[model samples]
Target: MRFSVHSVSLWLCAIPFLSLVGAQQYVLHHLFDHTNFFDEFSFFSEPDPTRGVQRYVSAFEANAVDLAGFANDAVFLGVDYTTPGPWRRSVRVTSNTAYDSGLFIADIAHMPTSSCGVWPAFWMFGPQWPYDGEIDIIEGVNTQDKNKVTLHTGPGCSITNEGTVASTTLKETNCNAGDAYLGCTQATASNDNYGDGFNDIGGGVYAIQWTDEHISVWFFPRGRIPDNVESDSPDPSAWGPALARFNGGEECHLPDHFKKQSLVFNIALCGEWAGRVWGDNAECSALAPTCDEWVADNPDAFAEAYWLINSVRIFQAHEA
Candidate 1:
């Protein structure tokens, strides 16, 4: 069904366990949507009729993008904040897919994304959770103090309760109390790199590097992050001490699951994760008085809490 609109292409490399040598060979599921530049579309309460995607997304910029603090030299994703959303205003895909890779990097300058029912996830997953897999590169609950970066895999899948990774001191001996995955561990700066620590630090760059031996992640502030990471699998030494170091060391049996998948960037409003933060609407306290305000304002302004993106570039580990 050609809607007479052009489609964009975004890519992510997927594989079960990838080495740096095989990372660059991956490509995107769809073609790059060049016409869908940051300025071309309008923010909407619904999906764009011309965008070509099956669902409607409040494209970035329509929300609220205040680039004052980050008057940086580079023009990332074209905006600074993110598009407000009940669902994802994804430039990549709406539904969601999973992937495995030697390396995956999400360079985001997230706003203080602490809103009730607002789950801003920059993560990845496999087809059927647990059995397939899920990697939460960046995820948190109601508050921003404690952040959680975990890997969920089993006969099916499971998730860890929220905790802070800013300290990068997470020392878990295993995954979900030994449900399915062999084991997992987290190592990061305790106060300034993991969880809200990363987001609070102006939301710079978060990279997850995976291999058959283990899965690890690192966070670098805007200027601190290097350029090579985007195109290559970085050595763990660069970012803290490998945020999460899962045991089993390749024996845990995480099969090949990473495949070419679409990138999903969403600012989900008041859903599962966000709802949990505020119980029965009572948790909407002063810290986030705008909780409901943003919700109410979403379709109205159709572009309030809009998170501007500068640019999203996906690089694959070149297979040997």
Candidate 2:
């Protein structure tokens, strides 16, 4: 279902009247493509916040090692697959722009495949950690077959997936970032929405609509993308049921929790989440004695651990 990057327009003209609510027009605000991805995103060379056994490199280092660049006219972010060491080299980037509310659309041609010790995510978070809220749009650990959309807030915030697809299961209701930070989570049912299955189908588009009232996420697999989306005018109301929807009524005011968020993409190895649950997964555990040990030794096994992003577009809603 995935079309070549050439077929999709890199520049999306602002659509003045794509409505999500009465008189609210969604207009194109930002576009991230191969031509400007490297410039717009800052390479994070800091120590892994998740304590993953992966070294995030600078833009210069990433480019020198072929860990981050452009491929097939798409933005490529990859990991070190040939070097055997305690920590594998990888790339993590965060957008320079931060947004409070908008519709985000990511057209991806490929993503890191499911593998033991590998954790890949495309998420957004505010500057002040849980206090400002975090949104996990596409995330999973280890060999997970499905994607999990989660929200993390400081306290006094809980959400319900009232309008999500039937196959999506709400795992937690409490979004309070307690000591463990087990945020509210929704598990998707489709295998094709994540990991190896996702890559096999030529990847897809992941859309997120965030507003004061609620936040919703949708996945349009390859050829199944709505005509409106391809045409630069997205109407979530006409996109049918979302894959995951977090309702923020009086119970949980979204604006109070989620604030200006920066988009992030990264791949980590043997991280807290993936490493902690390594023993529970029979397939992953059999590969080595421990997650870190396995990730350190098996360099070739992660050949497919990379992201091929066609483009990312942001649309902001304005009163018509």
Candidate 3:
């Protein structure tokens, strides 16, 4: 896969400013292969013994989702069970505030993700998307042509991207960063975008390296990663070429604008992003190509919809 080298430097040259902190220096939880503990799966879950309303988690507020309406909060996602759904679930780690220099890695082994209306995302966000900010480290709609890695901020922020059927990278800046939130497509993989290509070959790792000057990212399959490149702030010296790049110099006005972002792992079925793909699934059930249909037609692939999360770990490098 020969990514456009011309596109890379072009993105690098466009960014007037950057935050290259390089490698995290401390550990917050060091969550990798832990079995159990308080901070281990610290994101609250439904308490046992009680089986009714008490099993609901009313803390987090979802826009259209009603807390008590579903089977239980645990149905959404809880550490009690091996999976996060009555039928299926993905661990969505969220941070009220974003992290500055640490690195986050979600080792997701996806199932048949090529089906329609099944939008699974391993990404992060600020308090208010486009308002606080949204970093879609790895997100692709149901169609899967462009595996998009974008940064969303209000006005003041804008970006430029470059890539083809192989990969993409972007440099961004939030100049005015208006009151309302906005987003920009930072990096993407053209051929390897996000579709049959990624799922077919095998799900890979998506990384975001945010610094004071720039944010660089790379994706690697579990099998492709070398032994030395295992840690966060991976030795990019061995990193494959970045797929996309966006410039933020003239656009980004706030320096600490993208400070803290929480980790979120979710399999949002036919919602905003995915809804756009197959259509408003909920609104247009008959027309919308929902996963339910796939489950019936292609049971084998639909089984993969059960996203397999091997592990989600974060690592920080010591300062020089």
Candidate 4:
């Protein structure tokens, strides 16, 4: 019943070794929630990097303007719909730490709806723009019903849609960021995968697995999230085909293109993509002469634009 001091020390030493073994089978590295989300992320206050008709606010300003806060035990990232603007106020937060490869899972209850002039995204990007890499896990603009998963990288990077679902269309193969910024994109046909439809059913879980060979994204609407993911033993191989899968193939290299990437989330109004395509959308163009004018004048239209996130979990692959 009584163990010697040396024996106890030996057992304590073994504890760490045993834990290391367990950690080798995929362990949860980070858990981001309302309480610690701020500590892990920093609000961006610079001009809209993409020249969108939106102003990124500081943490102090976000709290003051009610753009970012905790509501119902969930972290809320919202845009100011009350303020008409040359500058529409919104929050853009970037993770303080960067990761090379991991399984990133986000449990979202709500996201900004797909409305005219509104472009919202949850993405990851490395420094130096296209040369490093950018992965748009969830991105869409201006009345789009489904999500667009894309990647932007320097030349020599290309992807193939070998493992994606049939309904998903590969828009481009080259991941290079040319003058148009069209990157390799995949369009999902699922009505409930993004925007108003996603929010209507209550937002769901989006999981991104980044590895040396390829990057894959999967979406699980509300009650459909896999048990393996819920339990932290995520096995992407068992998740069926991804909604979007970008394989480096021979022309591109994953490790060379994708470097340390920081997770980012933001909402913008009427810039390059949305503004350029505004005229093509009959419904949106009917509302106003242009995207900027409509967004500036119709503040009340975006009252429902906000993100309600439950948590984000990052897991690293381990070998058992």
Candidate 5:
């Protein structure tokens, strides 16, 4: 996206004039405000690739079901709650353009709650599945109280969570093609980071900084967002330790694994993750014999299945 010099000048004037030494400054590259959200993104009108019990609809269908619209100055993405569907109706949107490296920040007021058969995510992926890599930034499945951040790449790519917080646990170490399906996952300890606990606290901001050296994720509750973020000059160095960090040096090369990836946001129902673990979840398992059965029968259970996004901003590293 090309920004006029006037826009850049305005941003520079809004923030401090000087740049920090030994630190990188990110400039506002793309600002996806609620007003032009639908126009900026394209609806993914196809079957769920994961074979989930979901039917992705077009923008027109989403409008008809009141699934996608602006609510209270924020963008609302929701699923069909009242309709009795053999496959639940939902919406998936992909950004018009792709990015290589940048600081991606999402200001959310509410996200899909951790229900019995819901799988929601705000993630990114390349055209090539494992070859180009995928990043699951804010993702989790059924009845999960905490957020699970993961990375999926082709053969030879791996990461080490050496700089992550103590509360974050590494579920797997090798991020190769074998592990790509499941990938290298790190689960955040805070319940407030995702699901029902997150919504109860009025939601917050999730920032992801991707560079050649490392990929890091940080979560800030509603009132605790960094001042620099609001000023459009985010400095990840001052954000303390990230909740999850993937430092890829000699073990894996980032440019080889990650490429031009389009930003995506969607809520899938009873798919690979949610359906596979259905019987294990006592609360969810008690509702039906299978995940698909429960989702088809109880449509009202997903009344809280929606995303209330205030904004999504992308920042590119300012050249020195």
Candidate 6:
């Protein structure tokens, strides 16, 4: 979905104490490591919904061109660096299984860094557009050094950023998709949480905890990952404050708006976001007249535009 930024008043509230009933004991439900990632996730060889100037290639096409495969014991999803065409070749993959409330974790060694025409995202969405809901765990466009987390849903869904870290900024509260799908967004304060800065630290782990009451996201650099996260028994309660936290209370109903989400990862080039803001980015606009033109002509500039994922793990609460 297309997103727009607007000036909004900042909202900050105190974090509420969690009761025992709010805590959940989770068990690993699904694991997508390098050995099984290709088998479990399906390549989406369709037109970009965001209108990017990229051709999503099929699994066979990707493998044949070395755009999707294994490298350094991690699953590598990359864009074409040698071909110059109207549309650049890229990859987008979605998990076959849909999930409900759970803890999602992704361990990555590398990801596409900031570039003139690149837009990369790690997100989730339901079957039905807008009405079912969408969550952006990691997303940004050209020259964005920080990560932006957002939520898109149908009418009647507004959220508060009550449990997020103090430095995070909430750009909006209304998540309704009707208003041009702008979605409520929270901008992170750390440069090390995304793009070139993230890769320089050996791209760390991104964890999301989705519950009935709220959704929280956390980022841990290579050396700072929690012990429980490394051991496979994640405890969100002990993780301290989240980087971005969206709370559902009187303003919104969490379960009613979000359900059956499928995980997705993709890198789009010269899309709605990157293209719309091209001129505003002095560094990128100086390279070429337009975003699409730059992406089509400068193939080698995207050599660092790829994803090297170690694993994706999903954990669900054990049934009583």
| lDDT score for residue 27 of model 6 | 75
- Off-target runs (Cα >4 Å) in candidate 5 are 1-23, 177-179
In model 1, which regions exceed 4 Å deviation?
A: 1-98, 156-166, 169-202, 227-240, 256-262, 280-306, 311-315, 318-320
The sequence of per-residue lDDT tens digits that candidate 3 reaches over residues 104-155 is 5555444325456556565665655555556666666555655666666665
lDDT of 5 by residue, 1-320 (tens): 01111110011112224453444578777777665677778899888998899899998888766888777677888888888867899989999979999999999989999999999999999999988989999998899999999999988877899879999999887776465788888999999989999999989999999999988999999988889766657888888899999989998888888999888999999988899999999999999999999999899999898888898888888766
lDDT of 6 at 306: 88
RMSD of 1: 9.3
TM-score on alpha carbons, each prediction: 0.57, 0.93, 0.61, 0.92, 0.92, 0.92
* Candidates sorted on lDDT, descending: 2, 6, 5, 4, 3, 1
> Could you tell me how far off, in angstroms, the CA of residue 275 lies in candidate 6 after the best superposition?
0.7
Model 4 lDDT tens row, 1-320: 01111100001111111123543456677878765777787899999867888888998888876788777667788888887777889889999989999999999988888899989999999987877799999888899999999999888887888999999999999988473278899999998989999998988999999998889999999988889877756778889999999997688879998999999989888898888899999999999999989989999888777888899888888776
Best-performing candidate as measured by TM-score? 2
Which stretches in model 2 have alpha-carbon errors above 4 Å?
1-22
Which residue ranges in model 6 land beyond 4 Å of their true spot? 1-23, 177-180
Cα lDDT for residue 206, candidate 5: 94
Give Cα-based local distance difference scores for all models: 0.43, 0.87, 0.44, 0.84, 0.85, 0.87
Which window of ten consecutive residues has the lowest lDDT sum in model 5? 1-10
User: Which residue pairs clash within candidate 6?
Assistant: none
Prediction 4 global C-alpha lDDT: 0.84
Q: Which stretches of candidate 3 lie over 4 Å from their true place?
A: 1-29, 34-91, 95-98, 160-182, 190-196, 231-233, 237-240, 279-302
